[model samples]
Target chain A: MNEDAVAGEKSLKGIAVYPGIVIGKAQLVDRSKVKIQYQYLVNTEHLNGEVGRFEEALRVVEKEIASLKNGMAEKVNDLSFILDSHLMILKDNMLRDSTIRAIRDEKINAEWALKKSLEKIRKVFEQIDDEYISNRISDVENVTERILRTLSGKAQQSLSEIDRRVIVVAHDLSPADTTELNLGRVMGFITDVGGRTSHTAIVAQALEIPAIVGLESATDVVADGDLLIVDGSTGVVVVNPDDRAIIYYQEKKLQLEDYRSSIARQSHLPALTPDGQRITVMANIEFLEEVTAVRNYGGEGIGLYRTEFLYLRSKGFPEEEDLFEDYREIAELMAPESVNIRTLDIGGDKFVSELEITKEMNPALGLRAIRFCLKRPEIFKTQLRAILRASVHGHIRLIFPMISGLQELLDAKDILEQVKMDLDRDHIPYNEKMEVGIMVEIPSAVVMAGVLARHVDFFSIGTNDLIQYSLAIDRVNEHVAHMYQPFDPALIRMIGRVVTAGRSEGIRVTLCGEMAGDPLCVPILLGLGLDALSMNARSMPLIKKIVRAMPMSQARDDLKEIMGLYTVHEVQQYLFERIGGMFPELREKGYL
Target chain B: MEMVRRLKIRNSLGLHARAAAKIVELADRYESELFLKKDGRQVDGSNILSILTLACPKGTDMEVRIIGEDSEQFMTELDALFQGKFGENK
Candidate 1:
């Protein structure tokens, strides 16, 4: 069995959107090959019948959509808007009337007429200048494709039906198609194209399904009913696995479930050390809808609410009221628990089409974050006005990102003050004492944290950016990503300086980067005296469990020993030994 | 009675999806035969696809024509919509 597995096993790598392991039979769904046969009617008398056929197809697709909506009604929230829009497209006169006209005038079959109508509409959409607006063409295509599939009698092959559990392999799954999947029978999904932030990925995470996207050729390579193993955490897909490999994955799958159940049991408990020192665990979110998940995972508050998504998702600048509504909902939902809103961290990796920011040789160091806001104060002020208006709804704290020095911090604060004055003059109620802070990500910010701390209420060390900037490594560049070490002696010492500065000035300091949620680094961060650890919502439970079992005093002693280590390897090994010795149960459970 | 109203699209995104949805929602309320004209191209007021095809970007001048018993009332409501910038402020 081992030799057979070694001889026949093939593995593929992709982006891990959700973490789980599953072994199941492969079910390939190739919607891209759904070809529409263009046929012409032989007689003029057939026009009425052809139109009727098209109408019937539309009705059938509408019913399918309604059932899809019904299937997700209680389990999913906020999906009705998208499903309703698809229903509207089904009833659209432009689509219906144009197809009817084509069938009557061109003497074409129902499928051909509908395709022609969709093609005409898609051509017009292509001419639109805005990328966000033009992207609507895909929605039109998705809807028309569904109707076309119904006309071709291929609609029933969608993931809505499966007598046995299978791993779905497809080119891509639309939001609507993803909702139609039978949760009980669908073990996981592997797609040819998608990233961690795509809508399909988000839905997969919400559904708690194991998914690996960007496989590039998973649909073409895997055949139906072939044995398959999907490890979403490692983004590895093994096809044609033998008995030994299947057994290995089955054991891993069980271990993952056990770990999840153990964490779920402790989710409601407070994150406290054995000595009774409390550590606040919060979630960093990019969308308001994630607040529910944060609450479910026992996040005390939203430590970092990224506001740039509102701008990037819109065709142009998001209106103040639209921004206000989003912030208000998040604030109202998490009242008494603080929601730290980071204002406009755009540039470098995130670019808005409307902004027309010229491509730079080094976007990471160029006009981004506070620099972009300072250059365009009106854009900055508009966001400030909306955030200020939302401040009165709940505990909302404003934090400026990428503040390289004191001037940028003061300038941003100055615009904020002006927005507040305008709101006050308009007789708008806002929290006058809303606390403001700056992210100490850049090395200069770390050097000048003492001065910056005096001006702001708190400091959040964005370790993701700090490590990149301090080490001069573009973490995204694969050639140098190996050099992006979080355990570097210089980086740890810099973090120590910032934490010390925040402590001496009597201001709370938080860590809200990828490093904060990492269980291996939690002790190091706690020993550095971080007031809060903000991470993804899913990571909070395990991190909290680890924090609750260890004493802060022991962690501090380990931190001292770690700081004395000369090399990154030495620090990591020493910390692992100490943490493993302290929690043998965790080590046995493969958590340490 | 027949009525016509000329207005400029003040919303930054022009007649995009949400804006078109709002227009269709409003137009569906009246029994009048409403049409929008921009650059000599006419589109049915209640049809989102036709409205989107017009590609009426921000600041584009458009004319709305209505012919029915309730044309005057429909014209008044549409005039308010235009004046309000379709409930979107720059």
Candidate 2:
């Protein structure tokens, strides 16, 4: 529950990332960036002392990286090489000599002089034309950012150490914060930033926790240990709910628990529509630990197995053995069913954006996903080799992310072929017939799906990016989030084109997006005749129940009527009216 | 000894961080001044960032100039490292 709303109840609103109701004491963690941005000038007498302070900070950072290296190497030896490179950067002469020169000659404090030197080096890095080599600018940025944090003497709060079950409220969780946070102790979370598909939001959905994000001021409003009621379904946070409101939520909580238990009992059943059409429902997961949850939630297999954690966990392009171990575990765990591994889907900006390195207006539009991988084929090859090596352990397929063009698709395949040839020469065993696919997210990819369909084994539609890119509205921005509509007539037609293209090529077309998990969007997906629907594991049972309840002919008929609708509101209203009439029992069961 | 040798950067990633680290580490062991000249721009061999700035891709022909007593020994080690592609087989 929330802030020091001690005397009276208050209401706050945000975009709901996950659907659930939870009442807990608020844990107001201060994840504020250190404000070491103050400026100072050293006197001529103190300039040497200022220079000495900078040297000491470098030593501190060096020691920190070394310790991280030693500790991480114990688990994965390949990680140490990445740190060795960082060490070399830390001790680079231009970085050290210039900072010293700035302190002595310019008569400024060490922090400011170091910042100046970093700016100079960044300028040099910016001039480089090679995008991959230019991206090394972030390595410089990270080393500088680490040193700045060291100088400020305010280390980040290790979120994994939180012991008590509570609602975590933060300004914005960095990629580090999102990955390392202790989910076992978290009851719910509310943040001042992030959209429905943001890193933190995806984590919350995968773990099925109650979370609300983009509150704009939750950090300013919520106080520690205050009684707060978070309704993730309604995107409402009540600070210190009154007795009457408590009674209402208490009853609703019981109903949720009841519905959850009932769903778990039937989640294992195959989803067959009334017209005898079977749909494969899989789960999108980031961590290997989430494999168990997919099995429990009746997921047929893993779809969109995001490989972001594999690289981030080890702090670099992870070792092939480590990647192989993880992929093999998931493949073996989900034996008969296939696991679709989506390769690294991040960009250079993810590491630098939060650190304030460069002013990239839109990280989404910048170099990311397939573009990033293709630029640095060394990193891409590592993951491809791991996936290929792990294919023999169990049923595994490969899916590349953000394929905006046919060339990117072909280039990725060429790398895959090269890796396979390397493995063949080395006598390493792998599934030679492993299915390869591409995520149809970018608008250009959808328009050219017909041409691209000739090459790939399957297509997994990533609707989150499709909606944002096509609509030209940033979902994270609350101002334009209202425009992030799933039922827009344009999207329906685009999806129809993709489905027809896939059908003509005789390849399975599935969806692995947030839309697949949504109850209201289920009929629309069914109408498109998608072969498989993958989503958050928790959403599977309800989706299956809906699939069993409605006939495909009915959904197709409903789709035909909605396809002619001009606006998002009209389409949503029509679906709501149709659902209310067709599935009256779902409403009674609290499923509608 | 004073000598100059031309060598090709053979690694898939070019003169990247780890490769540069090997060159820097080798240069530090001998009392020699080693410099790599690529495309008319030369950088100190003992400095990692300088080597990175050179940005020599996999097939770039780099000119190495050395001066001092241990120049011969330094050349032998640098040649071995470059030929082995800094042991990066990925």
Candidate 3:
């Protein structure tokens, strides 16, 4: 087998978690610890004063921990427990006692004493022979980072202090490091080393940050203040980009930024085609904080709320109250706006230890989402009960995920009925009239949409998974990720089948995956008769802008003409030439 | 000395809750006032509010603190929780 050769030169590439091009000089975020020996050498003449210095360092460490915890809690809900643990470690009496002893007995400095004790902790973790335990070494590293920064008297100036919008070039960044970056000022990231699942990469994706990692010598190649062009979607970073390329990119970036504002202005407006057809645009969110997107970004309501995130977090099942309160909060927030909650799409990549939902031989096709929920009827009922209970607070619609065929649909309905019976028997108040829907993810569901449509209130096509399952490809698999095409005629035909099926039965049809948010696929989805489009709030404005610019009849005709042709590349090119300037940001991001 | 209390993970996403609540729960079970630490930072376990601030991810090992009375027992149980994958279902 011929192995692909690694690029030896300095290069930068990472998944475009966030989209935007930023070019500026390299501002290295120094998270490294200071040398302990240097501290001892400086303080050798004043052994008595070293204690006071150590005490001051300890105080600074404690203060930083408190501030860090407080800051993190403001953005994310409950991660401070780890910070408390770190505070205790920084103040650990045993570690402190031993370090103090070492300082006097071995003539070692405070940093060395701490480092020496930390070595023992690493050893203990190493003996456990587990990655989870072993990774705690970072905790030590984090504390050291604080202590060293304090010692160096430069603890307060973090990555965020880089006051200009520029490409962030680093050797590698930790999750904490990535979180601290001022997203507005930071245009892109170029790291020397990191994989797709690295904390830096994951955070970048969630923030919609344009990043490129795993490029060796990226720091050296891109000097401080060098003009660089980062293509996050393609994991490409052009250092000192040519003048012509810079001019092209600068114009493209401006157009994209302008389009975003324009979209923001029209967020509240109905997505009306030139021919006067209206389509509902909804938002997809993973957390409660994102609820504001509905009003701020012009979403009718949440199209899909992946409930598995709730299940993955708890040690056991989320209490009925837990699910109830969560759903209720989301519903009440949206109030008049509709919220479609997708029941526990756990299993596969999403796992919960208490669920006892074992990984299968093929997790993608195995017991997951609706299949897993159906297997454990009691669990499904608990969720259904919570969703139905919350329905009274808002216009809530429930959707089931990964329905392969009609049987699964029937089984889900059966469970929903059982939940209704349990609630009725208990005289629990719930919205009995709330509509139910199914996610058309599997090819089997897409093919039998007509039959499946009859059982559900609506059809929200999950195009991300549908395309993956249809092509037998994983969008994350670098080698085959290219194979994961959104506009493939096969997928277009599949979506067409579901849309036609839903329309035939008077069922509302929507697309709630990344594809729906895509400008290229927007016109096609409209032409195929999709009732609504739901996606990230960020994409809502632009999608609405594009939809409003086109006539429904013209869009339909154009989609028909394009679909008749063959090849993914052709489909992309046609969309590029047709919808080019309307979605300049999408074009700048190289979605074309 | 060690004091131990059984606490179920209440936060969504178990140990990985935005504040690393499980780690905090383990640390709070002692008089020395345990801390579940990551990097060089310490999160007080007994402080529900404090622990919820750590943001440790799922399957992450949190540093446990056992300061005063019943420190030994709390340490043992906390160690077991980490060893047992925080009772994570397979």
lDDT of 1 by residue, B1-90 (tens): 899889788877677766776778778898998899998989888877677778777888999999999999889888888778787765
**Mind giving the per-residue lDDT tens digits that candidate 2 earns over A1-592?**
3223322447788888887788877766553343456456646668777777788889988998887776553554545655777788888887889888988887787778878888898888788765556667767777777787777764333222235467888877766665435457788989888788777788888888989998888877887667778877767888877886777777767787787778788999999998899999999998888888899889999987988876665433567888899999999999999999999887632553212224457778977788878987987999899999999999999999999989999999999999999999999999999999999989999999999999999999999888988999787676777678888899888888899999999999989888888777888999999999999888898889889888999989989898889999998888777776776645544444
TM-score of each: 0.77, 0.71, 0.72
| DockQ ranking from best candidate downward | 1, 2, 3
Question: Local distance difference test, per candidate?
Answer: 0.81, 0.81, 0.70
For candidate 3, write residues A344-435 as lDDT tens digits: 88776554444555447777777888888888887888899999999899999999999988888888898788889988999988998899
Ranking by TM-score: 1, 3, 2
**DockQ score for candidate 1:** 0.49
Tens-digit lDDT track of model 1 for A458-497: 9999987899899898754534555667788888899999
Q: B51, model 3: CA deviation in Å? A: 17
lDDT of 2 at B59: 93
Docking quality of model 3: it rates as incorrect
Which of 1 and 2 is the better model by TM-score?
A: 1
* Poorest 10 consecutive residues by lDDT, candidate 1 chain A: A1-10
Interface RMSD of 2: 1.3
RMSD of 3: 8.2
